[model samples]
Each structure stands twice: as C-alpha cells, then as structure tokens.
Target: MTTLNHYHYKRLQEFCSSVFVKAGVEKEQADIVAASLVQADLRGVDSHGVVRTAIYLKRVEQKMINPKAKIRIEKEDESTALIDGCNHFGAVVGDKALKLAMKKAKANGVGMVGVKNSNHFGTGAFYALRGLKEDLVTIVMSNASQTMPPTGGIKPFIGTNPLAVGIPCGECEPFLLDMATSVVARGKIIVAAQKGEAIPHGWAIDKNGKSTTNAEEALKGSVLPLGGPKGYGISMFIDIFSGVLTGAGFGKYVNNMYENWKAPQNVGHFFITIDVNKFMDIKTFKHRMDLYIRDIKTEPKAEDVEEIFIPGEMESRRSEQRKKNGINLSQNVQRELTNIGMKYGVSLKDALMLNHNTEGKGV
Candidate 1:
C-alpha cells in the first residue's frame, strides 16, 4: 500500500485527464471524468476511483464509449428532462444531466432528469452532492450491467443498481446516503480478486448457485442482494426508473463494462433535485436537521458501538483526514495506474515529484 498526498493525487488527476485527452476526449470533459474519479478516492470510495481508469481507457480504445459524445435533450419541460448520452463516459454525461436538473430546480423548485445510453458514472454520490452545494435535496440513481441475481434465482438477471441522496444541514456536514442494492458492490469483488484475497461468504454465489468465498469465483458467478428479496425489489425498482423509463438497456441487455468491450454499456441514470425553501424555510430545515443529527449521535450506544453516525458522516470525516494524510492505494492499483501513465508517455514517478514537499510512502 502507498499513501499519496492530495497534491500528488491531484497530479494523478491531471495525468488521467491528459490520457483521456490523448484518447480523443475533449479537454474539459476529460478533466470532469478525472476529477470525478479522483474525488471517489478522496472520499474513501476507492472501488469507484482510479482503479477504473484502465477499464475506461480500454472502453475508449474499443470505441465502446465515445470520447466526443454529444449529449442532447430528447425531451424537456419546465421541470423535467430526458437526455440521450450518445454513449458518452458516464461522468461527463452525469455532470451535464445534474447541471440541467439544478437549473430547472432553481426555476421551478423541483427538477427531474432521466439519462439514457450512458456509461458507468462512478459513484452516484458524485452527482447528488452537486445539489447539496446549492442547498437542495438531491436523489440520484443508476443501473449497471447484470451482476446480481434475483431472489432464489440461479443465474444473474439484474444489476447492482445504486441510489444516492444528499441533504444539507445547518451545523453539520451534509447527509449523504449512497449504496448499492447488492450485498456488496461488484467492484469490491473485483478489488478482492485483484488483491488475490478471498471474500466473505453470503456476498456472492458460484455459477452452480452455491455460496463462495473465492473472489474470482464470485466474479464469474453472481452477487447476492443486500437483503435477499427486499434488495432485489429495490434494484428492480431502480432499473425501471433508470433503465426502462429512460429507454436505456435493462436487465440482461445492459452490457458489462469489463466483459463486453465492443458495445456501449447503455446504462441509465436518474436525478431529482428539490429546493428546500419550497417546502419549508431553508434556515428552519437546516436547524431541524442539525437537531436531528445531534439527537442521533448523542443517543445511547449498544455494546462495542463507540458512537452512532449519520449517513455519510463517516465518509466526510474520512475525506478530511485523507486530504491531510494522503490517499492510500493498493499495490495492484498503483501498478495499473503506472502502466496507464506509461502508455500515454507520462511518467507517474515524475508526477509524484511535483509533490516533493509532501510526506508519504508505501507500506
């Protein structure tokens, strides 16, 4: 493991941006994609972070993701919109969709946007947090390639669809809830496989529909839902809104980002923004949220529980700590990033030199 200072991590972003640019992506869009990926790492969501650079780059090379994708509004109204991503990188398309939703929310007090034909959009929180900055409540959802099997099913039929919500408070950090409907995100299994580590039982099932701890077998099989039938229902609900409603690929039709190299992922995303002031005085709402958070944190703790945490509180704390101490990347991730940089004639070692003033090292 190596801890990279924020300064060096920023340089990593710049390097990734450069690589995307060389791959025919627009400079601005490339930067957005890079920032989104790096932000995932900064916030301690390493599964959605730079670990994805190689796959994304490969997708671009395979022409599965259009570097110069032209997203357009397919339908629009005062407070709603439907966007066609034109097979663009998910981060770029997601940014555009969220911005448009914020614009509509500002004017109408609420906004809803559905996006189709997008790629993997990293973490859903990245888009929801946009509304938090504007003092609005935001909800984001997206469908992914098939990886999770429905309750009692043998083979994979649906994705580990995710949901993220961001709500601002007066005196505390914004509340963010971002989660996959599966028992564990597929990326966790991929990371485990990369590190040659075994997974926990109940996380996934082998091809024969038996529980397995081997990460590679899990990947080759199917992930379990978060709460059996309940999670499966939730994932299916998300797919309906993000995939079927948005006219994107649904169920088994969504192409796997890792397995399918030649076809577009055709994933879908949904965003909704609500202006707090419209329902209640913004100040009052914030004050109430702070009070609620206080009560929850100060409540009695069960045995071995140090404290209760509001959703997203721990991640906020992790981000602040990481900003100062630097981000830790696994050796496999480091090697992958280094190889990607070399492919683009950019030396990661040289990039690290840009942050010579910072202190950190591999463990």
Candidate 2:
C-alpha cells in the first residue's frame, strides 16, 4: 500500500478535475466532481473514491455523461422542487439539489427535492451533510441500476439503493448513517476484484443463483439484500422515492453505469431537510441529541467489546486523522491512478513529489 498525505490527495483531485475539464466539463463542475470523490476517500469510503475516475472518464468519452449539461429546476414551490440533471455528473446535480433543499428548509422549516437523469453521486452522506451547518436534519437517498434481488427471488431486480441521514448534536459529532440496502455495495466487489481477492460468501450469488466467493464472479451476479426482506422493502421504497417519484428510470429501466456506455444512467435521487428550530429551539435540540448520544456510548458493552461508536463517529475520526497523517492507497489503486494521469498528460509521480514538502509524509 502507498500512503499519500492530504497535499498529495489534493493534487490527485486536481489531476482528476483537469481530466474532467479536458473531457469538456466546466472547471467549476469538474472541481465539484473531484472534491466529492476525494471526500469519500478522506472519510475512508474508498469504494466510492478516486477509483471511479476511469469509468467516469470512459462515460464522458462515450457521450453517456453530458459534460455540458445544463441542470435546471423543472418544477418548484416554496418548500419543494424537481430538478432535471440533464445527464450531468451526479455530484454537480446533487450539490445543486441539496443547496436548494437547505434554502427552502431555512425558510419553511422543511424542504423536499427530487432529481432526475443524474449519474452516480459518490456517497449519500456527502449530500446529507449539507444541512448540518444549518442545524437541520437531512435525509438523502439514490437509486442505482439493478444489482440486488428482492427476498425469495434470484434475479437482480433492485439496486443497492443507498440511504443516508444526518442529525447534528451539541457536544458530540453529528450522527450520520450512510449505507446500502444490499449486504455489500457493488463497489466493494469491484475493489476486491482490483485486489485479486476473494469475496465472502452470502454477499452475492452467481448468475445461476449459487453463492460465489470469486469477486469477478460476484460482479456478474447479484448482490444479496441486507437482512433479507427488510432490506428489500427499504430498497423498494427508495426506488419509489428516488426513481418513480422523480420520473426517472426505475427498476429495469435504470441503466448500469459500467455496462451501458452509450446511454444515460437516468439515476434519480431524493432529499429532505428539516430545520430543528421548527420543532424546538436549536440549542434544545442539540442538547437532547448530545444526551441521547452519551447514553448510547456509555451503555454497557458486550464481552470482548472495547467501546461503542455512534453513527458517523468512526468516519469523522478517520477523516480528521487522514487529514493530519495522510491517506493509504493500495498499490493497485495507485497504479490505476498513474495510468489515468498519464492519459491526461500529467505525471502522477511529479504530483506526489510536490507533496513531499507538505506537513505530512507519503509512502
């Protein structure tokens, strides 16, 4: 594994941004995509990080992702909006939607927004965190191409369908829950494949519905829903909210980002924001949240347990540490990044060299 300091990571992000710009995306929009991807890596969610650059570039080359997309509000009211992404990068569209939702929530106490024709939006938590600075509770969800099957079925009919929620606390860090309804995200399998590692059983089934351990095989198969029927139900509802409600592609109509290079993904996302001041004073809400988190953390632990963690606590800690100490990237990821950099006429080695003078060290 290679460790890269925050400075190096930033350089890498700039390189990615340059690639997007070369592919015809506006500089500002390219920066947004790069930042979103790097933020995932900073938070230790490598599955949604810079590893996706290759595929995204391919999509742009194929004209599947509209680099010059003009995202616009199709319909709107005081507290709600429908945005058409026009097939732009998901990060750009998601950021616009979240800001709109936060603006409405601040004015009306609550806000809801739906997005259509977007691409993959790094991580749901990224958008959910938009409302945190405003002392608002935020919920974000997105529907992907079919990768998981409903309970008692073998064929893939629903996507991983991730959901995230962020709630601010007074003394503790905000409570954030970001997860896929599937047992594991498809990106996890892709990562395993990149590392030439075997996947765990029960995470997915082969094309014939048999459990598989080979990551490559799992990629061609179907991921299992988390907790069986419960996860399936949650995923279905997410599809309805993010896809059906937004008039975006739903179920089989959604195109796979990796498979269908010629067509837009038509992915949909849903966002909701609630201002805490609407229900009670912001101070009171924060205090209650702190108390709730304290109780949960101080509860007795099971045997062999060292400590308890609130949602988003571990990721936040990792982000802070990575910013100071540096981030570790696997050799495979580094090599892939180098290739991408070369394609864009940038020297990854030079970029890393420039970071050696920074505060942190890279290995």
> After superposition, which runs of candidate 2 have C-alpha atoms over 4 Å from their true positions?
1-7, 350-354, 359-363
lDDT of 2: 0.88
Over the stretch 75-128, how does candidate 1's per-residue lDDT look in tens digits? 999999999999999999999999999999989999999999999999988887
Give the top-scoring candidate (lDDT).
1
Report how far off residue 145 is in candidate 2 (Å).
Answer: 0.2
Q: List the residue pairs that clash in candidate 2.
A: none
The sequence of per-residue lDDT tens digits that candidate 2 reaches over residues 267-354 is 9999999999889999999999999999999999999999899888899988877665655667887788788777787666654633
Cα displacement (angstroms), candidate 2, residue 154, comes to: 1.0
Question: Lowest lDDT 10-mer window, candidate 1?
Answer: 354-363
> Candidate 2, which ten residues in sequence have the lowest lDDT sum?
1-10
Model 1 pairs whose backbones collide = none
The clash tally of candidate 2 reads 0
Task: Tell me the TM-score of model 2.
Answer: 0.96
